[model samples]
Target: MRIVVAVSLFFLTSTVFAQTKKPASKAVAGPGQQVYEQYCLTCHQADGGGVPNLNPPLKQTDWVQGDKTRLINVVLKGLQEPIEINGETFDNVMPAHDFLSDKEISDVLTFIRSSFGNKAEPVSVEEVKKVRAAK
Candidate 1:
């Protein structure tokens, strides 16, 4: 009886392990994506459509794809005034994220510019440093 039970348990465990085995995921998120998910995803949302009348949507907005210097400054200095984008006015206060490193800022900006259907150039770490220095 013991021998039969041991064999049954061994086969059951082996079958369970075999059935539970899963393929490794191939869609690993990039560093920029990681940063966006960690910080920007809250306000901007995963789809880049911000909350109505509060945080502005990032989808194809000039702010994401426009002048690099101005965009970088927006991240470093934060915007307090009510701003209009695509004819929509957003009055929410965007706190300054100056604590993020130049690379982090650059990566996040680049991620935003490339994502959300915006075809802007990538923001280099050097550019972020320059903008941060100017402030």
Candidate 2:
């Protein structure tokens, strides 16, 4: 009877394990998405469009898609200059997120680069660290 009970318990546990399996997630978004959700979402919105003249849209923006250095500088040093987005000008002060770790910044930057129809090269932590080390 004890042997039978043990066999039953093993089968039950095996069935449970078979029923429970993790589904695979899509491509990685890195820390960029997390940082954006935590900091930029309130103003930039989830769609990457700024609040009219307040915040600027990152979707297909020249500044966001034009130069890698420009984008990195904006992330590391913050952008005080007025930026034009979707035919509107936003002079808001974007506080510098330099405090974020290289990996976090890299992930966030990579997310931004690929999202909002703004397909671009991925930003790496090594690149971010290189930029930070320069200053």
Candidate 3:
């Protein structure tokens, strides 16, 4: 009985004196990154180096860094025609992502433009909204 009481008291004291460990700081995924992982990670890959001969890469590509409106439209209306980039032709089809909201599209475009070693301006929500409305 004395041993059990001592053990219980020790555990209770330890519990009262225990210190909490600080949580490790982690890089939080933004809304755009979450959207990309869900919808674009498959074809574009995690590094944005798309599948060879199947999908065009997003690294330092003009299409990803070019006009914001055109990029927005491409997301809204899937590309059907084959396009060549860096002397490489990709005939694979890219399905439309029109189901995404204007904010989502804009955030994703901005994320793409900034990722994969591309330094480009962000795509505003208004810009995406305007392009979607025009279509």
Q: Top model by TM-score, which number?
A: 3
Q: What are the per-residue Cα lDDT tens digits for candidate 1 across 95-129? A: 88888889999998988898878888899999999
Question: Which residue pairs collide, candidate 1?
Answer: none
Query: What is the model-wide C-alpha lDDT for candidate 3?
Result: 0.86
TM-score of each: 0.78, 0.77, 0.79
For candidate 2, the 10 contiguous residues with the lowest summed lDDT are 21-30
Model 2 CA lDDT for position 27 = 36
Off by more than 4 A, model 2: 1-30
| Candidate order (TM-score) | 3, 1, 2
TM-score for candidate 1: 0.78
Candidate 1's C-alpha lDDT? Answer: 0.87
What are the lDDT figures for the candidates, one per model?
Answer: 0.87, 0.81, 0.86
For residues 1-135, what per-residue lDDT tens digits would candidate 3 score against the true structure? 999999999998787656322222223467788889999999989999999999888888878998888889888998878899767999989999999999999888888888888899999999988898788
* Sequence-dependent TM-score of model 3: 0.79
- Model 2: per-residue Cα lDDT over 1-135, one tens digit each: 999999999999998876664222323444578788997788889989778877888899877777766788888899888766777878988888888888888887788888989888898888888888887
Write the candidate numbers in order of decreasing lDDT: 1, 3, 2
Q: Residue 135 CA error for candidate 2 (Å)?
A: 1.9
lDDT of 3 at 53: 95
